[model samples]
Target: MKRILFTSTLAAALAAALFMTAHTVTAAPEGAPAPYRHVVLFKFKADAPKEKVAEVVKAFAGLKEKLPAVLSFEHGLNVSPEGINDGFTHVFTATFKDKASLENHYLKEPAHEEFVKLIKPVIEKVLVVDYVANFVDHGAH
Candidate 1:
């Protein structure tokens, strides 16, 4: 009757308030050691052949074996969930220990220089961004 309905409404309101309070109180702590994140976007030239593009992919993929600065790395072609992206031939993500390590990766790594040579002809444009991960949860991926 009225009493049962009143108790149920109060219980639901209390649960929601408790849930919001817990979410507010449990934020991650600050000043965690930062990880350098690198994102690369490649656009192949119009005249670039298919085999040459594939070679670029393969050559870039080989860097993980030779360069230890590449703590985490992956390269993939664009395949949209909605299926409508006609741009950006390739995307690469590489995580480094820090900013200086990333610079070392570019300057000291022979394999990366070699990769540049492989892509010089077929690649028309290259975009790179380096960032630090704040609260990167692997579970989301």
Candidate 2:
């Protein structure tokens, strides 16, 4: 009977530890800074030239090197078969070190300003979303 009781207690302790570990792994760190993501979606004017659009995308991607705040940059053309993009054809993502870097450095950087000027004429509509990137562990799901 004592052996059975000991085994049950051990099992309960092990289960509690596993539960704590899972929660710890899944929880976001308290007060830790995460990278900021700047997402831009562009819908070009119907008459916008293809070359100009290409140039704009190229210029935006180059901001990663031109701006000290940009940690990474990438862009992609919309290819969703769902046809629910609302006419947004291009998507660009720029990762910054933090919100401060994006708000202070990248926004005021001349290179970014130039890119905005270069793209403005051809761009019909633009949507930008900025957020602190709190990544969830995919495996945890």
Candidate 3:
């Protein structure tokens, strides 16, 4: 019957549309999600004084104001908070919409560069982990 054929065709079309949408949503931008992770860890040099570390922390916190891509910034001097143990001097997490935004934060933002320059000498090592947002809860933000 013509009705049966039309119904089948419609079902096929709907399936195709759904597949396309799912594919598009899953296909994140380049470097959006790395296989490993996106964890930026910074270790300051031993020569850095306590006051200098505090100053650098303030400067790093100010990055959010200078860059729109950086939606939120969570930073603090690494300390064993009660029972939790974090073995590091400092830690800051920067979240962006995509990898491009993160790259722009480094390239386009002048203040970011200044912050880098200010802490370059005292910085021991920096670790960066880039990854995609597999499952994000919008309500949490």
lDDT of each: 0.79, 0.86, 0.70
- Estimate TM-scores for all models: 0.68, 0.76, 0.59
Local accuracy of candidate 3 as per-residue lDDT tens digits, 1-141: 999999999999999876666555433445555322235667878788889888888888888787777777887666665744333566778777667777765546888778889988878888766776564333331
lDDT string, candidate 1, 51-123, tens digits? 9998888887778878888888898887768755446768999888789988977546878888888899888
Task: Please state the error at residue 96 of candidate 2 in Å.
Answer: 0.8
Q: Between which residue pairs do clashes occur in model 2?
A: none
Please estimate how well model 2 matches the true structure, expressed as its whole-model Cα lDDT. Answer: 0.86
lDDT at position 140, candidate 3: 31
Q: Which ten residues in a row have the lowest lDDT in candidate 2?
A: 20-29
**Superposition error at 90 for model 3 (Å):** 1.3
In candidate 2, clashing pairs total 0
- After TM-score superposition, what is the CA distance of residue 130 in candidate 1 from its true location, in Å? 0.9
Runs of candidate 3 with Cα error greater than 4 angstroms are 1-38, 79-87, 136-141
Model 2 Cα shift for residue 90 (angstroms): 0.5
Score candidate 2 by TM-score against the native. Answer: 0.76
